[model samples]
Structures are given as C-alpha cells and as structure tokens.
Target: MSEIMENPKGGCVLAGINSVLSAIHRTCPVYHSGPGCCMQTTAADQGQSGHKHSCFVSGVSIPSSNMLEKEVVFGGVNKLRTTIQGAVDIIDADAYFVLTGCTAGIIGDDIVSVTNEFKTKGVPVYAIETPGFAGDSSLGYEAIWNTFIDQVIEPSEEKDDKLVNIFGIVPYHDPFWSGTLEEIDRILSKLGLKVNTFFTKKQGIETIKNSSKAALNIIINPWLFKGPAKKFENKFNVPSIRFPGLFIGATDTSEFVREVGKALNLDSELVEKVIREEEEYVYNYLAQAIGVVSWKRFAVVADANNAVAFTRYLANDYSFTPVLVIISEPIYRQEDKERIIKRIENLEYANPPKILFLSDQYEINEAIRNEEKEITLLVGSSNDREVALEKDIQFINGAFPVNERLIFNRTYAGYKGSLTFTEDIYDNL
Candidate 1:
C-alpha cells in the first residue's frame, strides 16, 4: 500500500545536491535532467528557505541538459557533454558537478563517462549519479560528501591539530545554515581552533580538497553522514566526534564547547575560561529578559536536528513545558529513532514530550490535532503555520521552508545565537 504525502517539505535528492554545491564559492552544479528540475530543485530548498539564494549560481541560472524525449530515447550523453562544456566555458566556477535527475537516471545515461571526459581535459568536474528517486534531500547531503571522499579530498601527511571540519549541517535546507556555521566558527575560533564550515567564509572546492588535514570531523547531527564519516576516517586517518544534536542556549552550547575541548584534549583551564566567559555573556542577557515572555507548553515540528535542539532548549534551558515534538523528517533506522527518542526523553527538568517520526503534512497535522496534551507555543516551519493558527496557538517560524523571514546569517546555535533565538521568541510573543 502506498500513501499520499500532502505538502511535503524539501525537494528530491537533486535539490539537496544542488543546494550544497551551489553554497560553495565558485562552484557550479550542471544538471543533466529534464526541464524545470533546475528551478524545482532550487525552489524546494533555496527558494522557500529564508528567501535566500546562492551567490555563485543557483535557481534558473544553473546549466542543465534539459533532457527531452529525443535525448531520453537515444541517451543524453552527448547533450550532457555539451552542457558540461558550455557550463565550464561560461561559468567561472572552480569546480563543476553533474547532478543527474530522474530522467537521466531512468534512461541510464553514463554520467560518469561523460564527466570523466571532462576530467581528462583538466576540468574539475565530477558526476553524482544518484537521482531524485534514490532518496530524500538528506541522502543527497551524504551522497555529495561521499563523492568528496572518493573524488575530491586527498590524503595529507601533515595534519593541523588546531583545524577541524564540520558536517551534518546541510546548506539551504536548514535555512539558518550560513549563520549557524558562522556562529560555530566564531565560537571555535575563540578556542584556538580553525573551523571549516564549508558553506560559509568563501570556502569552496579548495577547502574541501585540503580538509584531510583537519584534526577532527565534528558532525552535529544525531544520524547523518555515518557512512561518509567512516570512509573519511579510514581514508584520511582523521577521527570524528558526533555531537548528537545541534546546540542551542547556554547549557547545551557550553556542553558542546566542553565536548570539543575534551575531544581535542585541549587545556582544561582555557576551556573553562572560554565556557565561563560565554556563559556569563548569556546569563547577563537572560537576567535582562527574565519574565519577558510567559512560559507555556510548546510543540515543535522540524527536522531531526532542529527538533532535538528546540525540544532540549525549551524544556531544559527556558524551563518551558514541552507537550509534543513531531520530527518532520524521514528517519528510518530503529537505532536512529531510539537515539533521538533518548535525547528528547532525558530532559533536565520537564518531562519528555511525545515524539513522533513523521514527514507527510497530513499525518503531521492530524497528530498535532489529536495530541492529548495542550500546546500553547508552536515552533515550526511556514508549512505548519496554518495548523497552529487553526489551533489558535502562538506560532513562530523556527525551521526550514521559512517563507516569512529573511534569514541571512541568522542562527540559533552557540552562546550569542541563543540570545538571538530568545529575542525572536520574545518578539513573536
């Protein structure tokens, strides 16, 4: 039996790949799919995500083969070759990636062979054969990293002890990705570490190529990049630390700092000093904003990473009652679900909210409507706004498909970011 998903958030895997590649500076994604894929993929992630688009190339501007019936019947190889060459000639990109759509994948176009031809000519082009039907947008994130591990990143004899690479934060898809990465980079910099956020600070293929020199790979998600992380470790000899979830507010952010410090075996004195300074900074703001907003039971509908961060921060940091939390992403593995459940359940003060693994909009709405617990504050994406209104709850746009807000360099991670998040909550109220 098949189920119909209503108003599902996020595009296919192609959109995910496109979003990632486009985020990198001077990197171009040349699509080898039918017409409208370029635009649809762009709209799925970047378009609805905080009204921001890639500065390098995105949306309709990206090159595509636009595989038609003729090309699909006889194979779109030659057309794809020309399209890649044209993109390489016109677009001043440092590297190019050929992303196949369902059309190319269904017709069995040899994208690897075509991309290899460009590679022979010293063109920095790679092929990602995974189509939109392969998986969701998160899979696209992992697929791109796999491509990097296999094709882009090179081994280095010397590793920088102070350098680290960040993973699990998908660009455009998260909407707050740029700001979140920048905030993480800013905090890590105070710890005498150089952070590679990949999507921010004009980092592109060159940064990725040299990422093998990083001392550690910090994956800030509960369940993503598992295979790529293993492959990265085996190939580059660099270890990784999984943070389990994105950190928000002082408690979790401070814990994140300490964890990173411990992983690197950094000086305990320096680590404590940094944590003390950051906590003091946050507490100062907390002191001023005490009782500004009334505490109420809240429900969050977001992806796994944001869902965990929101649930923990609201229940633990703000001392707000959590009633329901719908993880609005497609999570399959039982271990992953259990891990997410564990994090959401083991709250500091409040009881764990009811957690549901849901992606379809209809089911999500029905679950929220049928919740036994009362919800007063709702934190969700734009798509969930209507449901909140129907329930007459206070709603704030906190996750992806953020159509209402213009979110450039705005994040809810780390010490300062938590303040911004608090400010938004207050403002919304």
Candidate 2:
C-alpha cells in the first residue's frame, strides 16, 4: 500500500520521520528541536497516539539528543549549529525553518546566528523566533507570517494596478478557508478588483511580494490578522475591512455584504443587489433550520477573541442567553477585549450572562458546576474533553480537530458561515 493509504488518518509523516531513523540522509531533512515542537507543528493527525505513530513512522533527521544537558543548562549555540549543519548535509529542502520551541524560548537560544552560519555558506536559511509559550496558534502564525513577509516582499520598480492582498483564515484553524477564499474571489471579481490570496494552498513564494500593490485588503479573522493588517496598512497604505464573522444565519450575511459594499464605496444598488440575492438563499434555509431552539443557557471557553465574538453573537444576534463564559486570555490587546465587552453590555437579555476573565481550566470547570448540564453549551478546544468527561456533560470541540477543513467549515465567518453554525445546534436537537 502507498504511504498515504497505509495511514488513512494522514500517517505519511511517519515515513518522513522514520526515513531518518537509521541515519540522517539526503532524502530526509528538516530538524525540529525544543520540547513539544514535534507535536505542536503537526497540521493534521494530532493527539498522542497520532503523533507517536508519526514519530515512529518518520524519525528525526538529526537526533535531538545531540544537544546535551550542558547545552540546555548553559545555552546551545554550538549544538544548534551542529543540528543545522547535520540537517543541511542530509536534507535538501530549498530552505529550512529553524523553529524555536518552548524550551529553547525559555532558555533564550540565539538560533538566528545558527541559521546565519548556514547562510554564510551560501544556503538560504530562515530563522523563526517562535516562542511557544507566548500566545495562541494565531500568535504562532503571526510569527511565521511576519517572517515570510519580511524575507520575501521586496521593493519593485512600479506597483501593478488592481492588486489585492488576502489576510487571515489559516487552513488548519478554519476548515472552510479554501471556500471562503473562493467566495471572496467571486465577490471581488464582480467588483472588478484584481486580487491575490497569499498562502493559497498551492501559492508560490512570489505571491507574497506581489501583495504590495493590492488596493485593499480583506481580513477574515480579526484576531490573527491584526498583525498583518497593521503592517499592510503602514507599509502599503492599503485600506482593510475586517469582518467580525457570523456563525448564526442570513441576517448576518446581509450585514457582511453591505458592510463590504460600503467599504468599497460601491453604489447602493449594487450592494443591495448582491445582498438581496445571497440573503434570500441564506434566510429561507436558515430561518427554517434555526427556529428558536432552547439553547438559552450556554458556556463558552475559547481563545480570547473567539470566545468574546462568539459570546456576543450568541447574546445579541441569536438572542440566546449565556449562563457563563470563560475568555481564555485576559492579556490580549484592549481594543479586541473592549469590542467583546461592549457587545456584551449592549445586549438586552435582562441580567446579562457573566463573562469570566480568567483562563485556569480548573476554575472554569468549577464555574460550570453551578449550571445544569442540559442548559449548557460548551464550545472550544478538545482539551475540554477531560472536563466534559468528568462532569458527564456534552460539549462541542469547536477547534483543533485532527483533519483540517479546507475553508472556514465552522460556519462562523460569513453568511453561509453563520448558517453553518446552526449545524451543532441542529445536531444537538
């Protein structure tokens, strides 16, 4: 059987690692070091069993054990160099991303210098300073995105007309990213705008640089896109419209199209035309499917921004009252947090649901103890699996599924996206 077939759950990565087990060779390269790097970077096929299967299937190109305790205790510049050199000697990828993991981040290793050593040897090396402990996957993405932009985008003689940049919506996090991009493409084409969706599944390196000429930028997710959005605004002066994401139904989709229409200064007739056509299809289906179900009392614990936006949407748009919500991080920028809070306060659900400002899983669990199981709707990570298991409560793991969705499959971003949100609600019925 083929390697892909052998691992029905996308187990081909094991061959990538195991090929290195015997000895580092020309075919197998790309060494990942530091604690948890191996597990965290797997885009698909996660979980302990899946990762272990992958590791056994594909061994490390250069065994990380080469970096001894002395290196950990003091620092591992030499060790990192040795690892990179070994990777260079054995693997033949065009470039290597020397990712800094939790341990390396904590110890403060100068991995840039190590990568530079290889660059001096006339090899293209990219140094990624991603400290795992810092923030959510969005933050990790920003680290890589910023690095890619800095390295690749260059000054050109002149900018092309009708260029546009696509931001937000990483494939792993949002299953519907591919479809979302396509939808965006259709809308922009109608508007007669030329566009570039950087990091499109088969995107080439040149696409990143060409983004400089985009007249406008559309950011799908506000949380992660904030970094790139700011950079694009400052560098390219491209006006950006950030869609807050709709995960309920048609009214939300109409609002999204109208908002984008206004941002582009499109005529009222055109905006209404687009909105009416899309809105009718969504409303007819969703209105029937989303008849006021009794999801009154809800509990949401998610990444800070997602938790906030979802909670607000539930309360104001859907008219469902949340019993308790735990925003996973309190230290996010005030602007982001403020938007969430403002929406919560503006809702008319009598005594509004409490939004917890803490992240301790134990504390969150304790809070949920006060609510009845049938009244609760737990949304967020699969990590909450243990919490649900212990409490005999049903929960929806909104993010971090093993196989990634091609587009924003969660159905929370656009009009159709909002309609899709009813899937879980419909299922629970």
Best by TM-score: 1
- Candidate 1 residue 399 Cα shift, in angstroms, is 0.6
Q: Report, for every candidate in turn, its global Cα lDDT versus the true structure.
A: 0.92, 0.54
Q: Model 2: what TM-score?
A: 0.72
**Candidate 2 lDDT tens digits, 34-67:** 5334533443322311122222113323234234
lDDT per residue for candidate 1 within 209-317, as digits (tens), equals: 9999999999999998889999999999999999889999988898899999999999999999999998999999899879898988999999999999998998899
lDDT, candidate 1, residue 135?
A: 83
Residue 17, candidate 2: alpha-carbon lDDT: 24
TM-score of every candidate: 0.99, 0.72
Name the runs in model 2 displaced over 4 angstroms: 1-32, 40-66, 70-95, 102-110, 117-122, 133-136, 156-163, 170-199, 221-228, 244-248, 287-295, 312-318, 347-352, 371-376, 385-394, 400-410
